[model samples]
Target chain A: MLGGGFAEAVTPLNLLLCLTGVILGTVVGVLPGLGTAMAIALLVPVTFQLDPTGAFIMFAGVYFGGQFGGATTAILLNTPGQSSSMATAFEGFLMAKNRRAPQALATAVLGSFLASIVAVTLVVFFSPLMVNLAVGFGPPEYFALTVLAFLATSAVVTGDMLRGLSSLGIGLAVAMVGIDEQSGAVRFTLGSTQLLDGISVVVVTVGLLAIGEVLHVASRSRRAPATETVASGRPWLSRRDLSRSWRPWLRGTALGIPFGVIPAGGAEIPTFLSYGTEKSLSRRRGGGDEFDRGAIEGVAGPEAANNATTATSLVPLLGLGLPTSATAAIMLGAFQQYGMRPGPLLFTQESDLVWALLASLFIGSAMLLVLNLPFAPIWAKLLRIPRNYLYAGIVVFATLGVYTTRSAVFDVLLLYVIGALGFLLRRYGFPIAPVLIGVILGPLAETSLRRAMAMSQGDVGVLVDSPFAVALYSVLVLAVVVSLVLRARNRRRAA
Target chain B: MSASVHRTTPAGESPALGDGARSFWTGRSELFVGVLVIALGGFLLIRSAMMDVPSSVSFLGPRFFPVVVGTLLAVLGVALSVRTLLPRSAATADEAGGGDGSAVSSAESDSAEAGARSDWKPLLLTGATLAAHLALLQTAGWVIAGALLFWGVSCALGSGHKLRDLGISFVVSAAVQLAFSAGLGLPLPSGVLVGVF
Candidate 1:
């Protein structure tokens, strides 16, 4: 299966798509406000023209390539393109300012490549096991997992759990539109033909991520001030830097893999943890505050953690059909767009597409190393593009992308309505991921719960009757408790 | 474009939410959220109640999940609303605690929690531009409408180069039309100048 996947992935068409995806992903990642998830969200509609296998391969490339691009900006400009690279900025910018930018860039690149290899290898070996386990799941188990995903995303993705839940509720309400499959009764369409099909995830995402972003930037006329960066320097690492970085790279990958599986919303947690671990280890080694003065371990460890979590996060998305991050959620939307329901069945049914995607991930990460290592400084120059043109171009793509989704003028109008909502949500501190999750998983969640209810003939106990479901519920409770405890701790520390 | 005026007056100031108002609304905006959610919940409950039931044998029906979700939202809305009355709801004090946001996107949450005000004029202009695009899509070809969208949005974003914006917008729109029609095989609307292409 692995060999077959490699053969399929190396085809010229797949290779070209992968290259395009990674390059596009890197460009967006380097641009402020266009994070990986939003990039994928906007791209989903454009890739509608491509075959399923090629689209998935490209999406995978974007996912991997985004990590390198984000890290480059963080090191050189002290601005993290995506939030996952914030920890990298903590130490990376210092190294760059201290005139060791070359060494910092090198460690980040090598660490990401090594971590991607380690994480992807583990995924290749372990994914089939996850699929096997998921294959045994019933409606109850599936319902329980979706509930876990919903609750975890709502509670863990935002600062305020209530706000997150509110966003989730709005998404659910939106999802409630269109025909009810079980009874063929339309719920929230309000008697419109277009409403019968329900709101397109593509429409909502483009409006929210792109149009909403344009509005947000428009509202904040004070553009993010550009900082200085070097023009022509290839990232290079000395023997000393390599010796210092290898162990941290391994440790960071170890730290990040578990986060990929849990519905923890993103990789920021593991990156911070990896950074802390490196700081302590440096202290333990009597390195005299290496963390303060741009240590190689500081850059290596968190970069590894960020990339590792990105790769491993796909496991749940592919094996279990649960998306833990916004990017993964949109990718799930892409899968559904092709009428391929993700989960255990997808592994067996769309095995060719899934395996080819995994194979391309390996190829893409290797390409990321080659493309980003020497071109780190050049990618940072993307920031120098006129903000007016950057935003203007995004607006053009936003309207075009949405219009082409169904070629309906009404959809473009709907895009603005959702765009306003997106702008409002961002303005008010509401977590956007839950809305996407609620939009994507809301239907499956409803269907599974009703199926479980129907099967048990109204006995609610059947919902929690299974040990696997009970285990998932327990994890949910544990997550809530952990969050509460952490909140209290942080409050006390702040006081 | 008036740098002096913008510099003297803060960036986010418009005829909308002020900095003082924003600070008050920042963390404490739970009241606003609570009220909006309660309204939504009420609407959902009413809709679920009015829907026709296809069967009585099944314990769960089409309305069942919506009713449950509605009730949950309503209860959450009430909780948030009531919590606002307490001393703890002072998001003013939330500065320290806000830093401890979720692992997923705490970095971004920090900015939103900062209660940064919006420049409503530009925001409104951007909205109007989209509305115009929608209105003009049928009458105006995509090239004209799409270019207008690009130019309008750039102007709203405070671009000073009007002629340049127009030129760039037209180039972008025509290029997109060509790509979509020939390459992607999805034809866009060629409204007024139908035979030009």
Candidate 2:
């Protein structure tokens, strides 16, 4: 798997693909609504005929490319391409307004590149161990794992567990729409001939993420005009920015990897947690007033955390065959399409694919740094393009992609309907990620849980039987409780 | 656009959730979520009832999981509604509103401020252009459809010079033809324009 993988990835055609994909991904990433998920989704059909590994290499490039590219938008426009970069926006934008845009941009790029390299290194070493652990998992263990994933996601995805749980419940309901494997009974098809196979993952993912996001963008006004244009300074970080940022970068990286593996919400939690930690620590460091006003540490730490979490997320996806985010979930679908399962046995069964993917990530990370750090202005200009043409182009490409997927016009109709629903949800402020997560993992979770219960003879106690299961559930409960208590306290304090 | 006015005012103003709103579940949020929850719950309950439980499996069956999750959802939904409906202490309302001042707003629009209504001119125009592109792709082909999309968005962003727009429109579509069709080997739609190639 390794030799062939490397050879395939390094092929002239494939290298160009990786370069192009990373560049495109970064460009899209710099734009607020065009995320890595959308980029990958839009390109899926275009790359359908390429060798799967080559396709994946390009996809990987695009994923990190988006991360690298997001820093620019955060700094220049006060808008973050991904939620991971939200903290970056807080500080980077401040620096921009203060005319230190170049330095902020530099620090963000450096921090991201450094953190991503470290994350890739960790993924290379730690993935095998994860695979070993996953190899021992049974149906019961998998079931427990799914429950843990669901609970963690609920606790961390949103500020309110109740609302999050409500979302999760909706997702589960959506998941239950297909035919039951054991009983062979159709559950929620509602008798439509098209519904017999259940909702397509692509349809759901595209609907919830892309189309929804477009509508969300449509609901917002143009970004407020820049009140000031601080003179562009040297691109190099100042001595102070360098000194203040290193520790935060280290701290952010430390915080990122663990969350990457946890099922809750991947980078979102860590990014915020890292931000909060850096904020408190900055005060203790006697760095009095600058922290919230675009401290270099603020930009560095979260950007580092963001990239690290993104890279390490692959660990769980590749090792345990579990997806921790929307993008990973889609990648998981790609894996299944290639007739490969990404768990512990993946390394043993598909060593070439795994290693090549790992090596490609390293290569991709390097390419991302080179492309994003120096070329940020180009991406910023991309935002200046007209929206009318952009959305129109997307619609055209989207329909064509759908048509190519099955050469069916009916899919085109479905795409429009889904797009409309997506638009509505976005307008309503309903978080759409959960819906995609729901559609992707819903079937797997239900199937595994059902199988586990059957094996246990319907024992209610089986769920909490294992120590791991108990521990996982305890963490879940704690997360929910903590979120509630924090909210309550915050509310009370506000009063 | 007014620099003096912008400089004088703060970038972010506090959200104005009134202090008298006592419940954790506000009247409006409660009403909306309550109805949704109950409907979802009712749906699950009916669906679960229709499902057959396997006797051979004893406790485990298709109906068992659905029933449990559905009932929990319904019960929680009702509980939330009840808790929200009951009058709460003034202090709590004051507290909830005061915390996250930036998050709370006095305006009814504040509830959906982050994701609310906006001018739909661009949206409608883009939609119309997309509809046309998709509808006419086979007839007009990639050259015209693709050019229209690129130019449409450029126009939406406020570029008004006709010569500049047309030049860009042609350049953009030509590039798409070269990149997607020639380089990537993906075929652009062929219509009347296909004969030119």
Top lDDT prediction, candidate number? 1
Which tens-of-lDDT digit does each residue in A1-495 have in candidate 2? 445666757868777878988898888787666777777777777677777778788889988888766678778877677666666878788888888888888888888778888998899889988887777677666776667666666545554444445556766776676576677666656666666666656665555555545544554566554333342655787687798878888888888877677665546567777888888888887875887687887888888888888889899899887777767777776776566778887888778768878778877877877776666766787777666456545655666666666555456656666676555434433344555565566667777777777778877677777776677678777876786687778766765
True contacts kept of 2: 0.22
The segments of candidate 2 whose C-alpha lies over 4 angstroms from its true place after superposition are A1-8, A221-234, A238-241, A292-294, B1-113, B118-197
For candidate 2, lDDT tens digit of each residue in B1-197? 01111123232121245444522323233345556666777788897777654455444566656666677668757754564455544322422322111100010112224433344666665556556656766678777876776666555544558568767777777777777767867676667876776
In order, what lDDT does every prediction score? 0.81, 0.66
TM-score of chain B of each: 0.74, 0.47
Roughly what TM-score does model 2 have, to 2 decimal places?
0.81
Report how far off residue A118 is in candidate 2 (Å). Answer: 1.5
Q: Which ten residues in a row are the worst by lDDT in model 1 chain A?
A: A223-232
Find the candidate with the highest TM-score and give its number: 1
